[model samples]
Target chain A: DAGVTQSPTHLIKTRGQQVTLRCSPISGHKSVSWYQQVLGQGPQFIFQYYEKEERGRGNFPDRFSARQFPNYSSELNVNALLLGDSALYLCASSSPVYGGETEAFFGQGTRLTVV
Target chain B: EDKVVQSPLSLVVHEGDTVTLNCSYEVTNFRSLLWYKQEKKAPTFLFMLTSSGIEKKSGRLSSILDKKELFSILNITATQTGDSAVYLCAVNNAGNMLTFGGGTRLMVKP
Candidate 1:
């Protein structure tokens, strides 16, 4: 079975531009989450979607948004990107069973570099 | 605010040595704590700890959660060079959001 997979392994965009990153969760997974990891830092949660609905969101700005599809795939969009937005965007998926003890598996991540 | 803090930021030890990493968290309605190992790309799940005192072991790596003390520790015994990586700790709260610590970068020298 394939793990979480992300599209556009890398991207370079200019400031104020908009970019969309895609993720395909593992088969049978119902939850997809997005996270941002800056250089030398751990990933920070952005948004989590379960059953195609937004379940949780983090402290990210309004420019950052995400949505999960009916198939449990997800896309993370960042508008008006700034230099500070350059980082690795990771997609994670989990089954969300057994009272939330399920472990999340992550994708290789899309490395976005905003110039 | 909900926060997770990891100790010693980084470590370097010789192969065959043992090392311990610590994680402490302060969050509302705590549910579970997780450990991940990141090599160069993405992070891979290592362990998910909920109940306290019960140890979860995988090969040479082990972890234990302390809900009463609001902390957890990961131990690696007889470490090998392949153990070099950044170990991350995250806490899952009632809100279903994961708050991650800064992570400890471990470099096991051969």
Candidate 2:
């Protein structure tokens, strides 16, 4: 089975601009989460969607939001980007069953650079 | 707030050497701990350690979790150049959330 897949792969945006990153979860998976990994740091959680509902949210600000489509595909949006917003945006998917989420799989991530 | 910390922020070793990476977390309502290897982009899953004292091994890699002490360690034997990457330790807490540590950058010289 194919693993989690994310798109654009690369993104370049200007300060004050808005950007959207997309993710498609693995087949039969029901949960999708977003994370941001700054250079020289580990990934930090953003948001998680399961069954088209918001299940969890991290410490990110109001500028960050996400949604899960009917097919379980997810999209993360960041508004009014800042230079500090430049980082790798990752998408992880897990089946919601017991022990399923314990082993969430990650996508290659979208590299976002804000200038 | 949940926090995960990794020790020896970075390490350098030769191919034949073995290394141990440590992770300690202070998370509320802790559920599970996980390890991942990141080459350049997204991280790849390595192990999920839930039960205490039980060691999970794959190839030259092994990991054990200690729930009481709230720490875990990852061991890689016979390290190879291919093993050079950032090793991240993450914790899965309540609300189905995952929090990560700063990661240990490992560089193995062939």
Candidate 3:
């Protein structure tokens, strides 16, 4: 089966601008999560949505937000962009949340370059 | 605060050699530990360990978890140039949020 898919493989935005990234989870999956990975660092959790509900949030600022749809697709929105915001945004999907039984699958990620 | 740390930030090894990567974590609630291999693009899943002391293996790669120690180790044997990538360790908390380590860069020179 096709894994998680993300849109806009690469993006460039000016300071203070906003960008929205999109993700389509694998078929039959019900959870979507967002992560940000800076160069030389591992991905940091941003947000998680399951069944169209916000199940978890990370230590990121309020400028970052996300939502899940009925079909289990998800979107990550970042505002007030800064050069520090330039990183690879990753989308991951998993089957319905269970106790340690769910395995997350990742997408190629969207490279966001904020200037 | 929740945190995950990996040792040997980077390592260089010969193609036919074997290498081991380590990861340790501290969080309020423990759930599972996951390993991913990142090449030029996305990070792909390698293994997920929920129970302690059991080993997971796939070809030249294998991993083991130590719940009592709150850590995990990934081993790659008979490495090849294609095995060069960043190995990341992440822990899922009770909230279902994942906290990731800084990652270890492994270079397998042919």
Question: Residues B1-110, candidate 1, lDDT per residue (tens digit)?
Answer: 88999988999999999999999999977888999999998999999988999999999999999999999999999999999999999998854468899999999999
Q: Where in model 1 is the C-alpha error above 4 Å?
A: none
Q: Write the per-residue lDDT of candidate 1 for residues A31-53, one digit (tens) a residue.
A: 89899999999999999999999
Indicate the residue-level lDDT of A42 in model 3. Answer: 90
Worst 10 residues of 3 chain B by lDDT: B90-99
DockQ each candidate and list the results. 0.70, 0.75, 0.72
Fraction of the native A-B contacts that model 2 recovers: 0.82
For each candidate in turn, the TM-score is: 0.97, 0.97, 0.96
| Residue B18 local lDDT, model 2 | 97
For B6-102, candidate 3 gives per-residue lDDT tens digits of 9889999999999999999998888889999999878889998889989999999999999888889999999999999999999988544789999
Between 2 and 3, whose DockQ is larger? 2
Q: For model 1, name the residue pairs that clash.
A: none
